[model samples]
Target chain A: MTTLSLGAARAGVELRSFWRERDAVVFTFALPAVLLTLLGSLFSGVYEGSTVTSAQYLVPSMIAAGVASTTFVNLGIGIATDRDNGTLKRLRGLPMPPLAYLMGKVLLVLAVTFAEVLLLLAIGMVLFDLPLPASAARWLTLGWVFALGVVACSLMGVAASALPRSARSAAAVLNLPYVVLGFISGIYYTPIGALPDWVIQLGSVFPLKWMAQGFRSAFLPDTVLPQEVVPSWEHGRTALVLAAWCIGGLVLCLMTFGRRSRQTS
Target chain B: MTDHAVRVRGLRKSYRDTVAVDGLDLDIAVGEVRALLGPNGAGKTTTVEILEGHRSRDGGSVSVLGVDPARGGSSWRREIGIVLQATDDAGELTVAEMIRHVARYFPRPRGLDETLSLVGLESKRDSRIRRLSGGQRRRLDVALGIVGRPRLLFLDEPTTGFDPEARRQFWSTVRALDTTVLLTTHYLDEAEALADQVTVIAGGRVVAEGAPDTLGSRDVATVSWRDGREQTDDPAAVVARLTAAYGGPVPGLSVTRPSLEDVYLDLIGVPR
Candidate 1:
């Protein structure tokens, strides 16, 4: 009972702080939506030898891109800054469960990711002629794919925060790789199959690519499957790969959170 | 001694190869404001962190609230509060929001409004922590620490950098609190004003320990008058001589003792 109340209160604070920071909210939410709209229109034409319009192909990937950019940079930098400022130290000094603190931040991540996803989807459907999931099964698949992406990507952020020297550099240090991976994964304007084999293989190693694939499986019609690196939806492989990242990312988050929590320096 | 809030014996800690704390001991009685006085790098923070269970010690028998801090868990954590040395920056949390959030941690926390007013942040309740002055943030630190109504509160250098007015304001807030507080500070004057007992730790050992007024050896009293001044080892004798010379109580008479800083320098063998 204590844990629930404290956890709820902390999540409330994180949510409040998330939206209250105008620059961060605008950058995290608006940038992705704007990027999706801009890219979706600029490349409205279909790719070579494929009937799928760029709008349908890019929309699903951009949804994953939104979750990735927001969680990877936002959660990573948030944790690093908390450590640098002694806010984590202060929280460590409390009787509150550390998991409660983490749960609150995770809840905030999901909330922000939801808003980012909604804005992107709305823009995709309204502005770029992207279709909504038409069946109960399709909606369910989208729901779970989003859930998997959020958990895996956000935990990946927690692990990556260990890379930054301090809070000030966290954004630069953590965001660069996400930017590079986003570009390579065709989150911007690159087509997946159009990229060189090595670049596609490198993208495959990250959860971002798999997340895009999973979303594509749910959102894109069967006729458009050839554009993916797999040339088939590979739904089982998508779920397995994303789930593996979730479990592996969970282990990394625990390790990083534990080591970081014990830090007094 | 049995009712002591803290007891330590042969407390030792070494970081990498450098000795941070070497064989330190301390005993703080219940409800006493015990001040750990030392300069920077004097192992003050390390010693306090060990007691607060934030850091581990290499060799020591420690008891805080009757449980070894290393083994102490959440139940143990509930009995103590900590005011971390200010490192600045708490994001955009407002004064009230910060207090209210931390207040939810403890089993039975002090009232949010009560803690806010106690720290004299009533007017600044809506102000974000970034907008607050340094002293105001320190007060917020204290408010969060004591919101749990802890039996033992550890304040690690609560006022490291503060203007004279701000430091004085902070001292009053400390004085008004009802819990036993263990404050670490290098400022001798701060210790003199607030602590019921002062433990001077140097090179990770207790160099001196007693009430601030009685910690140093007896010394001469300095007397000043309108025209002249005198220092006599025996203040009573000086007073008698001055009274007799004036044929009554001395005129424009004033007495002075060495400030704690002076005594501290003497104890540490630093040339004044």
Candidate 2:
């Protein structure tokens, strides 16, 4: 078989193992959807002078968070666990190419992230009356934002996997940043404008904030524009920041991934 | 294509100020099962890792399957298999699934059923890897190593934690394979059982190299007769002289040579 097909087969294996774990499947797929339901119900009123309710505004932001969970958090802990378990060493001894292993990981992230988004979107539409993109342009924006967000987060996760000393510490290392970024990036809070200026500035430095903002522009109406941190959606800046992170993240991954000297045993 | 599956000259490796392997030389002919017998910290693992391409030598000319291991790539990797000392990977996958997944990496892998049976894991074929006992896990390690049908296999302390029965079974499995094997072991009996040639190493160098029965000065035999016992290089002559003296079948007569363990300890500088 060709390398691509072999990589696909590896993806199948990875997916099978992932599902069989039970705990990981529930944690990765269910967390964001559960959070969306509770948060959307608790914050019910529409924003001032706009038809978009707090829950409607939250749907898009939650979608962004779901993407991060499935890609960044998933790959981070997964790779670290693989390293600790001697999977990396065993694969290094085989005839398999490094690219094939990478293909398998990337494909796995893409698949789980796709499923995560669908589940979140389904909950948003069913529980909070969230609407789908109304036009091809809006759909295009969603497409590019989802694509860029998944790439940047996945790369960062791969790079961060090396930071933890072992698999036992991977979740603590990766989740600290993930949870902190969600709150500051306005996934939990609506109308990011309401947060302190310093908090807004801090959130602006990360990709999650830009991803949430991009998703808001696609799903929310212009009437809610006055409540945004910026007067406009600033789609140009959103694309630029997320795109830049993609490049930077890829560089970091290439530098740190698989660079550690493995034990000789 | 080379007559020797592995060849090394002046192999050297050091960690900081401590030297691991110092000017070691080795050669293994195709289809030869050579046992590298050594104590801990004697550079046996270092030498094997360098040859496996898992490590780099400080200075040496080393070749396995006619390629410098430091530069060995996927094509070179295809011709060799490695069973590491201990590992706990692929625990989530069933035995059959993990083996099948690994087999896809090679051009001509053994059939899954045949591979499982070869390692005596047929009963655990559908069981999760994490559920297997320690010995069963080691057998799985061996199964994965040979599934690719590699021409040369490197087994590093392959039976470190096995029971006697399991070790014997493992030796039989290794013997069944028609491939060149470089086995690093501490068990003299295991070496005697499986190796065609035994190389005893100490201080990162070969102290003795020969067949297991003749590795050290095994030519000296202890010839016992009814009168007494004598250590002699010419056991046949001594026995004939004793028989003539007795003028009949000798009583309490037996001839014995130094055991491999005795010779191994002497080579490694350990007092009996």
Residue B7's lDDT in candidate 2? 91
> What TM-score against the true fold does each predicted structure earn?
0.92, 0.92
- Deviation in angstroms for A60 in model 2? 1.6
Candidate 1 per-residue lDDT over residues B1-272, each given as its tens digit: 56899999999999999899999988988999999887778899899988988888899899999999999988999889999887665558898888877777777889978998888989999898888988888999999899989999998888878999999988999999998889988888899899999988888888888889878742567888776898876777777888888998687998888878887887766797
DockQ per candidate: 0.60, 0.55
Give the per-residue Cα lDDT of candidate 1 at A177.
91
Query: TM-score (chain B) for model 2?
Result: 0.94
Model 1, span A1-265: residue lDDT tens: 4777778887898888878877567766688888887887788577666667888788899999999978877888888877888877877777778878888887888888888888888888888777887678878889888888888888888988777879778878877898898977767755687888988888887888888887877777777767777678777877888889989998998898678666644
Show where candidate 2 strays beyond 4 Å. Answer: A261-265, B222-230, B233-257
Clashing pairs in 1: none
Model 1 alpha-carbon miss at residue A256, Å: 4.0
Residues A51-102 of candidate 2: C-alpha lDDT, one tens digit per residue = 9999999999999999998898889888988888888889989988877888
Candidate 2 chain B, run of 10 with poorest lDDT: B241-250
